[model samples]
Target: MADAPLNGIRIVELAGIGPGPFAGMMLADHGAEVIRIDRPGRGGITIDAKDPLLRSRRSVALDLKKPEAIAAVRRIVGQADGLIEGFRPGVTERLGLGPDVLLADNPRLVYGRMTGWGQTGPMAHEPGHDINYLAISGALHAFGRAGEKPTPPINMVADFGGGGMMLAFGMLAALLHVQRTGEGQVVDAAMTDGSALLMSMIWGFRGMGRWSDRRGENLLDTGAHFYDTFECRDGKWISLGAIEPQFYAEFRAVMGLDAPEWDRQMDPRSWGPLKAELERRFREKTRDEWVAAFAGHEVCFAPVLGFDDALADPHNRARGTFVEAGGVTQPAPAPRYSASATVAPTMAGERDDAGVLRDLGFAPQEIAALGH
Candidate 1:
């Protein structure tokens, strides 16, 4: 993709699980030449070539326990624009491939470090998954119903949204700074920080006294009758979000809710009974029937589609939101550009040790000595 936004950019990704690979995938999707350094005989969570996160990049397997392998990584990073690594704070330092060494080798290298707790905190070295990070960030407490346990959104919020996407943004920002100043810097992208940042709007609502600390007692958290999912007659679900007065009026008109009690749309006391009534009313029709009834209306309604249905959806199909690679269906690269078109994703392929080394300007003797 010669016209892609990141066409000339090159990223060296030290393989790890979760956010690290996702960041690499995002970069690679937009035409960054991302060289993934995988551990020898260990694939991490991206188990094989077909894994979506590993797509659109060439991989090189190297045993970091060996000093020669470390040298090889330095050699690769010397010519690269950036590097992404997800490890505990001091792990890379112990491996002799820390920011100091790599930045010394290449002054213009943007180094990105992804972690759950960040680089300097007391919990930085402690092991944690996305759930722990989200919990500590104060985002998880607002996730579930009012009286229920906080439901984890299955790692999507912290891991992919906050962690990986944040790292990608930081990497790109640092790379742009390198372009302008001829200087490189490290990006410490912490899931805790990122997840908290993702809740900025909620924090604003809290400060403005428009939000409740209770999970499901807020406007956008299914507290409103019009802003929640309802089960249909066929056992499927549909969601509604008619927040504005006009939209709520449209909802009432479309649904034929002529009851006088429905006038108290904002009265929280009426929410429970109204929601019960809505539940009963929605159950009178199938999901598809309701979808048809709400078609071409301004009620902000949509079916609660599962993955298979989402992939098959008409709108998603029109936008090419999902694509197939290596016979596996997955989401396409997002945030489409108007001028710089992105490259289509390709499945991860076999490691090309010598090929990658040669591309990094390694001599034949040095490549031989490193031993793939």
Candidate 2:
């Protein structure tokens, strides 16, 4: 889409892996001009220009080891609305781009810092990953089956959802506040806090005594027969989410389970038997067959689709949730709007450092003098 929502806003993204880049990408997709400050040369890392996460941003490779590079970054920051970084607490301060220095130069700069344990606390200085953060936040413990070990959701919970998305939300909120008061603030986005916040509904259930501590023993976790996956004849799977009584009744009808035992729908004791029976019955037909059988039923059914299958799913195709760009098929910009348009992802190119510097208000002679 053209003329995105964040059209003229500029963001300086200190190029880092994981959540930092993700946050930058989110802003860029929504129309912010995100200038990614990458390291000069490959810098021991293989450059994948086709990576979807690197989209919708211009990049300038600058070696922070040089004094001129640091000066250049400060100059760029002078004109940026916000800056994002995901590093250890003291790393930025040591690099001479600390909050105090940058904020002093640009009082309206929104300094966004994303981390696993946050900027302070006992574990703040320690290095960790998505699983570590989720584990501490009680999110990981709430996943998977009752008797099985805790299973991480492929870094979705802590990394993208908790870290990047939380940072983006905080950045926007702070930006709004800055607009109102002309006072920018630091946005400390931590994965642990976000993961815990994401469990607000579950926490509410626990407080109301409707949630169980055991993994997968809760209502939405795979404890109930009607809210789980069933393996079919062809080894594929189908999911059911008929929680309400009426929906459960329809589900039972679609499954042809009219026995009196099926009447004990909400009883925990009946779940085991119902699950076993479902396992046996579901094996009688292929996943597609069951999908067709319950096509028009209010049974809340969907076949378990893999990545490739999902790319071809009718609903996904109809909504254009994914698109092909730069010869790569990836997810499209989401949470669509009627007034604001979402921009297509952009690929990183052979960066023109001098060009970027010039755009950042650097003179051509100054750019040439910077060893570009």
Q: What are the lDDT scores of the predictions, listed in order?
A: 0.91, 0.90
- Per-residue lDDT of model 1, residues 252-309, tens digit only: 9998998899999988888889998999999999999999999999999999999999
Provide the lDDT at 16 for model 2.
89
Local lDDT at 67 for model 2: 89
Best by lDDT: 1
RMSD of 1: 1.7
Q: State in Å the error of residue 151, model 1.
A: 0.3
Candidate 1: regions farther than 4 A off: 42-47
TM-score of each: 0.97, 0.97
Clashing pairs in 1: none
Displacement of the residue 217 alpha carbon in candidate 2, Å: 1.1
